[model samples]
Target chain A: MDHHLILRVVTRLLVAPILLFGLYVQFHGDFGPGGGFQAGVIFAVALILYGIVFGLSRLRSIFPDRWVMRLLAFGLLLYAGVGVVSLIQGGNYLDYNVLLPSAKAGQHYGIIVIELGVGITVFGVMMAIYYGFAGRPPSIEDTDW
Target chain B: MTDLAVTLLLFFALVSTAIAIALLRSLFAVVMLSGVFSLLAALLFIAMDAVDVAFTEAAVGAGISSVLMLGTIALTARHEMKPKRWSATPLIIVGIIGAFLIYGTLDMPAFGDPNAPVQTYLNPDFIARTPKEIDVPNIVTAVLASYRGFDTMGEVAVVFVAGLGVTMLIGGSGGFLRRRYRETVLSRKDGQA
Candidate 1:
């Protein structure tokens, strides 16, 4: 895989921009055609592209399995935690009105935070799934392709 | 109209790609064709003005899933083995299911009909109130995260659980973790010597 100099160079150039786009989608979701799900998958695609071009071992070193597992839980907890905070604030579960002084402000803040949670979980899950599949020994060599 | 023409063309392409994927024995080709199918569907969604759905279909469906399928092929067989006997029963079952699905759609309203039950009911309320209530430009995000927060939380939970399942199956003990642990141990022992 390393012998393909062109592939490696192109991947290096593209990965940062791809990740930046994912963040843009994640944050700009309220105003645009993206949210946690799309942004998360896009972010995962960056890592997956890097993994494919370089190798799984290099990918794992950077995105350790332990962090992936923890973040997977962290995102879900963050989502639920938001709901609980709303409940504790004397609003219904997940009611964002109480999260801030103004109802609109709360809605804006709540949506952004929850979407971030969604983004994280999605990114983690996707990368985990890719790792799961690619970590298995390949039956055929690269030359076979 | 141009929109109709574009949609019909994309739909025809989608159908052809689906059939091609069904007919192809090569798993790799099937995966690639599925990605093409996702792209076509994404284009169709854009034509219908559902930009959010289009974005998701393009990114996850065409992008990540295709790559994942290729990774799967790397692990497993590239070509699907032909069944010893081509059975008519499975074909008959599929035909019956397809017939029922088509029949189900027959009762549904035409695409984008303003009077459609879906467009008439709760949607109007959301649209009218979203600006003042949520103050967000994208009603989809507002409804998904705040108005219908529980459902979205459930969806996130489902993804979390799915990741857990896959990690259990492929990340623990007999998987990458144990193997990496052994390598580290061996390296540490050699370093100490």
Candidate 2:
């Protein structure tokens, strides 16, 4: 992988834009086709591409498994927390209408926050799965491909 | 119409890719074909005006899954081993299941039918109320995040649990727990010294 100069250069050029696009998809989801799931995969794809090109160790060093696990739980908690907040506000669980003074604003805020939660969890899971698979010692060599 | 033509082309490509995946003994080639199959399916989703689904299918199905499969191949075998026996029972079972699936679809409404049960149900109401209620340009997002927020929460939980499961199973011994264990062992050694 280190010897593949072309791949390294191309990946370096592409990673940032890929990450930025993932963010665009994440935040712009309300007005567009993409949301948390798609954006999360895209975000993971950028890091995974970097890992494939550079090395898994480098990827881990940058991200770290501890943060990955924490984010995974935090995302789900955030989603559930929003629901609890609404419930405490005398609304039904996950009822966005009661979150704020205005129903529309509540819905907007609720949707954005929940979508962010979804994005973070998805990103965590994807990276975790990648780590689970790639962390293992390769039984096959590069020439095996 | 060009839409119909494009859909047909995508379907053709998808079937060919599936067949190629089935016939290929090389696992690598099969993985690549599966990615192609996903890409074609995403294109078909786009043709059907399901851009959100298409985006998800392209990103998860084609992109991440392909890379993960490649990682799997690196850990496992590159080539699928030839089956020692050609069993007709499994083939018969698959054919029967496939037939039943096709039969089930035959009772369903045609593609994009306005009168379909799905279209006639809450869909119309959701569409009518989205602008007034959520006011999001993307109705899908509104429906998913606001209208059916509970279901989406469940889905996020599912993703979290899946990550937890994978981490427990094969996430390798290199995270916080391992570091803590090492620290404890080092402290025990220091006490002995």
Candidate 3:
């Protein structure tokens, strides 16, 4: 991996744009053909690509496992919390119509918040799975590839 | 005509890739071929005007899964182990199931038929009311996030549980419980000292 100068350089160049694209997909989902699940996977892909190219240790330093686990739970909580808030607002559970003064605005806010929750949870899960698989010592070497 | 041609070409590519994956002994090549197969399926989804589905297939099916498979190969063997003996039992079972599935599809309405049950049912309602109610440009998002919020919540829960399960299983020493146990032991040792 150290000898692959071109791969290292290209990976460095590509990581930022990949992350930006993932954000675009996450936010633009309402108007376009992407959403939380796709966006989350795309976001994880940027980090996974960096892990594969640079090294797992380098990737972990930037995104520790503890943070990954926390984010995983937090995302689910955020989604469920939205429902609870709506319930407290006198709407039924997950009833977004009462989330705000305007029904349309409530729906918009609820959808965005819930989508963000979905995205965060997905991103965490993907990264966790990657860490689970990649954390194990490889039986095969770099030369095998 | 061009759409039909592109679809047929993609279908052919998908089938060939599947065959290659089955025949190849090298696990690496098989994994790569499966990714290619997923990409072809994504292209087919696009041709069918299911862009959201296409995006998911391209990202999760082709991208993440391939990398995971490669990680698995890194942990395990590069080449598949040859079967101890050729057995027709599994093949026969698969063939029967495939025939039953094809037979089942024969009774279904033609693809994209306006009169089909799915097309005539709640789909039209969702399409009709999405702009007025949810007011999102993407009907799919509105339906998934708002109209079917509970189902999406369940899906997210499923994803969360899946991550938890995997983290508990193959996560090795990375498990939170394991780390806590280690910390407790270290504290006990310090107290003893």
* Clash count per candidate: 0, 0, 0
Model 3 TM-score, all chains together = 0.94
Point out where model 1 deviates above 4 Å.
B172-193
DockQ versus reference, model 2: 0.77
- Per-residue alpha-carbon lDDT of model 1 for B1-193, expressed as tens digits? 9887998999999999999998899998899999999999999999989999999999989999999888778877788999898889988999999999999999999998999999999999999999989999999998888889999999999999999888877663345656787899978999999
Which candidate number would show the highest DockQ if scored against the true structure? 2
Tens-place lDDT digits, model 2, residues B1-193: 9988898899889888988888899999999989989989998998888999989999999999999899999988889999998889987998999999999999999998999999999999999999999999999999899888889999998899999888777764577555676789978999999
Q: Please identify model 2 stretches exceeding 4 Å from their true place.
A: B176-193
Tens digits of per-residue lDDT, candidate 3, B31-105, equal 999999999999999999999999999999999999999999898888899999999998899899999999999
Clashing residue pairs in candidate 2 (N, C-alpha, C atoms within 3 angstroms): none
lDDT of every predicted structure (CA atoms): 0.90, 0.90, 0.92
Per-residue C-alpha lDDT of model 3 across residues A7-121, encoded as one tens digit per residue: 9999999999999999999999899999899999999999999999889988989998888889899989999999999999999888899999999899999999999999999
Residue lDDT tens for model 2, A25-57: 999999999988888889999999999999988
Per-prediction RMSD in angstroms? 3.7, 2.9, 2.6
Candidate 3 docking DockQ: 0.74
Candidate 2, A15: how far from true, in Å?
A: 0.5
The TM-score-based order of candidates, best leading, equals 3, 2, 1
Per-residue lDDT tens digits for candidate 1, residues A1-145, read 8788999999999999999999999999999889999999999999989998988778888987778888898999998999999999999988999999998899999999999999999999998788778877663366655
Of all native A–B interface contacts, model 1 reproduces a fraction of 0.82
